[model samples]
Target: MSESIEMTAKAPVRSAPAPRRTTPAPRRRSTRRGPLHPATWAPTTVLVLILGLIWSAIAAEHPYILPELSEVGLALVDRPEVFLTNAWTTLSIALAGVACGAGTAFVLALVMSEVPVVRRALMPLAVVLNVTPVVALAPGLVLAFGFGMTPKVVVTAIITFFPVLINVTTGLRAVPPSVLHVFETLHASRTEVLWRARILYGLPYTFAALRVVMPLSIVGAVVAEFVAAGSTGGLGTMIRNAASTARLESVYAAIACLAAMGVLMLALVTAVERRVLFWHESQRRAST
Candidate 1:
């Protein structure tokens, strides 16, 4: 017994390791992308069904005021070329105008972001311009620029400019105070901060504005067409002409094209935003 005790005492002793202060692995949040995926077109499918039901009810009740979607479909099928031609004209001018306006707005927004004096002077002016009815402004633009694409382009620019400028400016100012202070401490140049931080952070905001402004550009173009007596072009002209002749089906058909155009524009912007902002946290959350 003595020998056994001595041997045991001589043996190495082991105590249980203090419970490891392990951080539990972070809970993996499950993310699924089946029906809810933005690419799934699920919402659009449901909307189309709802629209179909509404159309059927309207067609059965008052075909005169709101003609059957079938009637509009027939009109579109019968003279697709006419509709396409007018649509192209309107789209062309709207595209050009939006491009010019967006470029100008970007430059102006950047300047406003950098210069308090400019921001103070111009923001209210921009708001005033934005609030002025395009209906009223279109006529004068037409008179000034003559009844050409120029007036319509100007009108579209007027419509698209403010939203982009507002969003970009708001985004520029959204930088964290700490981040700005750090940059100042580091003596970063204005141009450096503008390009690397402000512009990068402002992308999401700018894109949101793009989505809102696109349809507005269409409305502006149409309004300009209404006032552009000598335009002799565009779906708006066709619409006004058809309405005057009491061709209600044609009017509906033309309006459908406008709706389609708006949908396409929104889709284009959404796709671009998704691609460009894939690394952003909000965008990543949406994707997952």
Candidate 2:
């Protein structure tokens, strides 16, 4: 009887760790995918391959004008500190100028958008500035702002502002009339319309402008530095110094650093766009 009771006690407990219920881990979005996903690394690989071939061709055909890729690589590897410091300086000028310029453009866009007459009045001024050759104006800017960071910053800003202004103005006007009408029916204020509808509508266009303007600002600052050449401590200065003594390797290295800086900024902008515009159709499509 005791043995029978023991067997009954040991038999079939109802609980068995509740079948180990677990939520599956969420999958990560991998930037690096297999060749099956050609969109991942195919273009980048192709670009690098093409660049390598062109570089080889240049090295073989015109050795004096363009140093071998290996030489540029050696120079870059040897002078890490110089490249880093100069790259930082150039990047700073680009960032500061773009931020300020984009802000000014947004304000001007708002003003022009709300008041149609301001477009006629303000556009001529923008056109004049846009048409003025920045290289020709660099010396004057240096004279006015002194041979320092101010001139470079101003030059960068001037180069970036107009394109941004045009983009923002277009974006603000691109809001659907139906959406505006809905807000109107609800008796929304001008500020509400401006912020909720127009600004949101303009974000993609503004980002597109940003992608172009940021690189142009970098170019602008570099050119300004060239015109105001000295110990300014930027990629432009490095280029000027290298070119003076015909150190083609160093010139190529500095140029490569400049390219890297532009690429980094562009990547950052793209990342921000992905985060901010995740709900947009483009982002949705890209993610899938």
Tens digit per residue, CA lDDT, model 1, 21-91: 97889987767566677757778899999999998798789877788778889999999999999999988
Count clashing pairs, candidate 2: 0
Tell me the TM-score of each prediction against the true structure. 0.87, 0.84
Error of 1 at 26 (Å): 11
| Number of clashing residue pairs, candidate 1 | 0
Candidate 2 on 1-288: residue-level lDDT in tens?
Answer: 999999999998776565677899999776644457778678889999999999889898999978899999999899899899998998888888888888899899999999999988999999899999888888888788887798888888889999999999999999999999999999999999999999999999999998898778789879878886344588998899889999999998998888888888888888899899988887877765
Candidate 2 off by > 4 Å: 1-39, 229-231
In terms of lDDT, the poorest run of 10 residues in model 1 is: 30-39
Error of 1 at 159 (Å): 1.0
Measured with C-alpha atoms, the lDDT of residue 185 in candidate 2 is: 100
- lDDT agreement of model 1 with the native: 0.87
| Model 1 spans > 4 angstroms off | 1-39
